[model samples]
Target: MGAVESRLAELGIQIPEVVPPVAAYVPAVIDGDHVYTAGQLPMVSGALPATGKVGDGHGLVPPADAKEYARISALNALAAAKSVLGSLDRVTRIVKVVGFVASDPSFTGQPGVINGASEVLGEIFGDAGVHARSAVGVSVLPLDAPVEVELILAFV
Candidate 1:
């Protein structure tokens, strides 16, 4: 296995299959030395684990749960990147991450939720995972998924 794949195995993570796009765009595209992934929802075996606005209230997805979803979304993004690059080992750096949280009006913990993605990337890639990021709160996401994530990677 490549270094990146070994790291994932150490973390007990198996990179999943690239998620099929919900619309017209491809899951990822390569331009020059960078790979840009489409927004990835927290899908497991082609289904969302949870769906709702994130907050502390009845019928809403909890922030903690949303955090987990963000992690899943990041993994999906990685899968997308891998599909295009043929391997994660070529990745030299995680250039950027953009995460979106379907949130309640009173919820303002978007950054904490996105930390799920950030932390996992750090664990998998060490210093190479450190990167610029944006955490945004939105009224809703495609399929009402609690969180979505996209990635930009610089590679050989």
Candidate 2:
């Protein structure tokens, strides 16, 4: 297996098949040495795991659950990015990761939740996985998935 896939396997993480485009945009775009991914929802197999908003009017899932979902979303983002870039070794660095969590006002640990993705990348890529990131709380996401993530990668 490839380094990227192997590493993920060692971590008990499997990169799922690339999710088809939800709309007009491609899953990822590789330009020069950088690759950017479209928003990735917390999809398992084919469907979203959860949905709703932060604060009021969306409380099907708790904030704590939302945080966990955010991490899952980030992993899926990496999967999407790898599908386009081919190999994580070719990844010079993870430039940035923007994670959006569908959360409740009482839930403010979005950054901590998205750490699931960050930790996975770090485990697989070491320093190369070190990245700039933003974790945000949003009202809702497409499919109402609890989380979504997009990645920016610099390739070798």
Candidate 3:
């Protein structure tokens, strides 16, 4: 197994297969020594694990389900990054993570919501997981997923 795969096994994570793009853009792109991943929604087996905005009146269950879905989205983003680098160990730095939180107008916990993704990165990559990040509340997301996350990676 590759570094990412090995680490995931140790950490009990599985880098899911690349989720097919919803539109014209590719799942990821490489520039020089960097890899940029498109926004990844919460997909399991090519289907959304959860869909809906966060905050009041969202989802038949509590919003926690959707929050977990957001975290899952980040895991998928890492999977895409590793696919490009061949090994997560090749990642020298996590440049930035931009997390978009689909939310009700009254919702304001984007940072906490995105923490679901950030925390996973920290656990899987340890110190290398640390990176600049932005969590923004948006009116909606692609396919109305509760959240979407994309990553930028600089490899050694």
Candidate 4:
């Protein structure tokens, strides 16, 4: 395994196959030295493990579970990046991350939820994973997924 893949293995993570895009867009595209990934949902075995808005409100997914979904989404984003770059080791730095949380109207924990994705990137890439980020709260997402993550990676 390449250095980045090895690190992921050490963390007990196995990058799944890149989720096929639901629309006309590609999963990732490389422009110059950066690879940009499409928004990735937390898909496992070709399905979303959880779906719904996240918040303390009734019928909403809990914040903790949403956080986990964020991590899974990040993993999928990593897979998409690897698919384009051939190996995660090709990445020189994580440039930016944008996370969207399907949230209850009253929910305001978007940053905390996005931290789940950031934490995993930090674990896999250390300081190189640190990057500019935006955590957004939205009423819904494609496939009703609780979280979605997209990444921009700078590579050699």
In every candidate, how many clashes are there? 0, 4, 0, 0
Residue-level lDDT tens digits of model 2 in 86-135: 76657778899888887776777788767867876788778889999999
Give the TM-score of each candidate.
0.99, 0.86, 0.91, 0.97
| lDDT to native, each model | 0.95, 0.77, 0.82, 0.94
lDDT for model 3: 0.82
Angstrom error of the Cα, residue 76, model 2: value is 2.0
The window of 10 residues in a row where model 2 has the poorest summed lDDT is 54-63
- Pairs of residues clashing in candidate 3: none
* Per-residue accuracy of model 4 over 48-83 as CA lDDT, tens digit each: 988999999889999999999999999999999999
lDDT of 3 by residue, 35-109 (tens): 999999999888876667788663432456666876798889878887777777788777888999888887888
Give the C-alpha lDDT of model 4. Answer: 0.94
Q: Could you tell me the lDDT of residue 109 within candidate 4? A: 98
Kindly list the per-residue Cα lDDT of model 1 for residues 1-156, writing each as its tens digit.
899998998889988998999999999999999999999999999999999999989999999999999999999999999999999999999999999999999999999999999999999999999999999999999998999999999999
Which residue ranges in model 4 land beyond 4 Å of their true spot? none
